[model samples]
Target: MPKNVKPVYYGDYLQLDKLLDSQQPHSKQYGPEAHDEMLFIIVHQVYELWFKQVLHELRAIYKEFCAEQLDDRALQLVAHRLRRVLTIQDLMNDQVGVIETMTPQEFLEFRDYLVPASGFQSIQFKELEIILGLTRDTRIAFDQQSFYNRLSEEHRVYLEELETHPSLFDCVDQWLARMPFLQFDDFSFWDVYQQAVQNSLDRDEEIIRQNAADDGQLETELASLQVNRDNFSALFDNERYKSLQEDNRVRLSQRAMLSALFITQYREEPAFHLAHQVITSLAEMDEKLTIWRYKHAMMVQRMLGTKIGTGGSSGHDYLRRTTEQNRVFKDFFAMATYLLPKSALPELPSAVRQALGFYFRHDD
Candidate 1:
């Protein structure tokens, strides 16, 4: 390390002069400045700053996953970084409350002054979505064009190029598909798992049949059970799984889905603990993001009622749709459906147990 260096001033080091000067309210540009506009601008600027930090963490995590192999230490680091992102998401969600402090009437004072500039033009937020794997095909129909149409040519081209790269979700799917635990000699883990699943489904069917009082009730119960049966059946059948994928019912590949399911079911195993944490963190991140979207939609409704967004979106209605559709980690959430109880899980063979455990042996 260098012993001597130029003295660092706080304002210059943090660039407070430029940062503090950046928030110029549109309302002020015209006439009387709306009081609440400052709060709105500052809150959104803070959000962009946080988005930059999240992208920093996500890029590092993506590099780790891009490696040919992720050792336990690398996996631990990935999980740690993901946890940090989750913490930031919690803060971002809570900050929505700060903006909510401004009443709808207050928002209306400056809202028209900033015509055609909506949250839809938030390029950093769009970058975050693209990096996390919300491709154009997966986005809500209006969103597929709305944001693109609103962006400048430079920003639009940048995001279009970004779409060509493998997102964090893509990297995760490939990594899970490569998991060595999915195979061991001629032993097939899924065969045992499928049998256990069948038994559980059978037990459920029996219970439903016994509980149904009349023919109409029995038919309805059976129809619901059939849907569950078909979902489970698709897990073990490649063609059926592919059909589901084609219909967009699932996104992760068959091998990756199975590997994720295995890790989730036997998360207590020493080998799977870190992987489990990664999946859990991703699911929580997805949930937090959804909560943020929902909150934003509610806020929009409170402010604009049924009005169209300044950027030409259907406003609250469009945002509400995105809450349901613009998800990158839904596969992780859906994986829970395929998990069997620990009690129902087959006891691992001795060799498999040794392979999964972190034990040391020595000659007496």
Candidate 2:
């Protein structure tokens, strides 16, 4: 029963050496395929490894909720892992910059060698998406890799545990019963979460209303607070603003639980696609989620123009159709659009374009 009694290895680098040596180029185009290309592949592979860790954290968080224990450790784990995932995504986005520095011609030299291989086919990414409640798409169904097949099994076990449990939303309902605005089930998870946050809004608004009645300094301070945030009355009420966003996941989890879809084999279901509200709200963060497939499509339009994806899917043209994804989150966007300055709302979707795409001058 001794603690920390595991065996140790001296500067052996056994697994490290094996992993480092695994990258192989498909062609002799040293500049494109291997030179900078090796670095690109390494970045993606390492990110996948980090994603693996993030998924483990998510699984742990989901388990804690199922156990009816929304304790500090579970909260810390969720925040820590979400931060890691964000960090990973940030790095992934930054890598686009690095890859952009490579001239299209330089990439083209090795692009042909990539042949049937593409990053979209990453299984670890698919697993991460699934764990985060993304079980609706057939994008993960491209069955070719034996390695990915194995990882998916582990994914199922973790998801199975969540499916059988009370889920985070259920726990939220148990935690905040009798809330007038926050109705459960029939109201929808998004509505429930929206109500929970609105309760805070309601409280803040009440504080304002009361202060005006009293003509008091504290109420005046509350009313004059600055308001600027991704969501809600951003009136900088320091303590209250932080508090509102802080417990958001509890709301988000409740949302996830309320709208949880069942992922099965045929018309399969899993609660992973999130309760839909997350996606809708995510639009405030980036409307591109709904249109990421469109952006991806645009990249195809840029790179290969209309060429097919390495996976043999319908390619960029097909991607345009999916730009309208996120069934549950659609409402989130609809809610956000209501807050827009009206004139700004119509042009919102095309406001930003991803500079990176698939080409260079035929001369280069």
Candidate 3:
């Protein structure tokens, strides 16, 4: 550690003077100040600050994933940082309630003063989304243009350049695809896994058949079962899985999907523990962001019912749609649908189990 350089004052270190003075309500510029406008501005400013921290964490995580290999220590650090992001996200979600305290009538006082400056112009938030892999194609129709169109030319150019780089989702896919345990000599894990899945599916079908009281009900249950059967079939079939990817039913590459599924299934294994935690944390982060979006959309509705956003967006409607569609880690959540019970999972071969564990047997 370096010796003391200069005396650091609290306000000077945090720039509290600049921070405290930054909140200038637009309403105050034209007419009597809207009291609640300060709260609105501060709440969003806090959100941007939090967004900055999240981006900081994500850049570090992205650099780690960009490596050719992620060792256990690296994976642990990644999980820890991701959990930190999740914690911040929880705070962001809860902060919506603070803004909600400002009544709709109070919001109206300053709302018209802020023209052509909607939440859509939040460059940090958009950067966070792009870095996390919500590409143009993945966005909803209105959002595909609105997100970029609303940004200033400089911000648009910066984000476009950012899009050229691989996203966290892309890096994660590559990492999972490169996982070493997908292959072994004289052992076929997926073969055994397939048979177990088939057995489980057969059992489910039998139960459904027995429970059905009429032909129509039986047909309906069978149709649903067939969908599951097709999904499981796609899991092992590369071409079929690619078809699913084409249909946008899934996103991760087949190899990466399989690796993620394998890690999730045997998360108890020493090597898979941190890997599983990384996936779980990413999924939770997505959920928290979605929750924030939903809360924000509701807030927008309260403030501007059926009103177009200042940035010419559909306001709450657009936000609500984003909550459902604009997700980067939905594949992780959907992976749960394909997960089989631990009881149904085939016991890993001893050699493979040993490889996954920390300890090695020594022959004397």
After superposing all C-alphas onto the true structure, candidate 1 shows an RMSD in angstroms of 3.1
For candidate 3, the lDDT comes to 0.88
Q: Per-prediction TM-score, please?
A: 0.95, 0.49, 0.96
Writing each residue's lDDT as its tens digit, candidate 2 over 1-364 gives 6786667675353676778787876655444334766755676577677667756765665564454433334444544544554555555555445544555455565676776676555666555444444324323234222224334466656644544555333443342231221232333333333444555555656676766656586555555532312334332234553565364411333223222211100011122122122222233223423343454466566666667766565566656655543222232333331132322222111111111011100112
Model 2 lDDT vs. the true structure?
0.43
Clashes in predicted model 1: 0
Tell me the deviation in Å of residue 284 in model 1. Answer: 1.0
Error of 1 at 352 (Å): 2.0
Ranking by lDDT: 1, 3, 2
Clashes of 3: 0
Q: Highest TM-score: which candidate?
A: 3
- TM-score result, candidate 3: 0.96
Deviation of model 1 at 265, angstroms: 0.4
Model 3 regions lying over 4 Å from their true place: 357-364
Q: After superposition, how far is residue 15 of candidate 2 from its true place, in Å?
A: 3.5
Model 1, global lDDT? 0.89
Q: Against the unseen true structure, what C-alpha lDDT does each candidate score?
A: 0.89, 0.43, 0.88
Candidate 3 lDDT score at position 127? 94
The digit string of per-residue lDDT tens for model 1 on 82-175 reads 9999999999999999999999999999999888888899889999999988888888889766658988999999998998999999999998
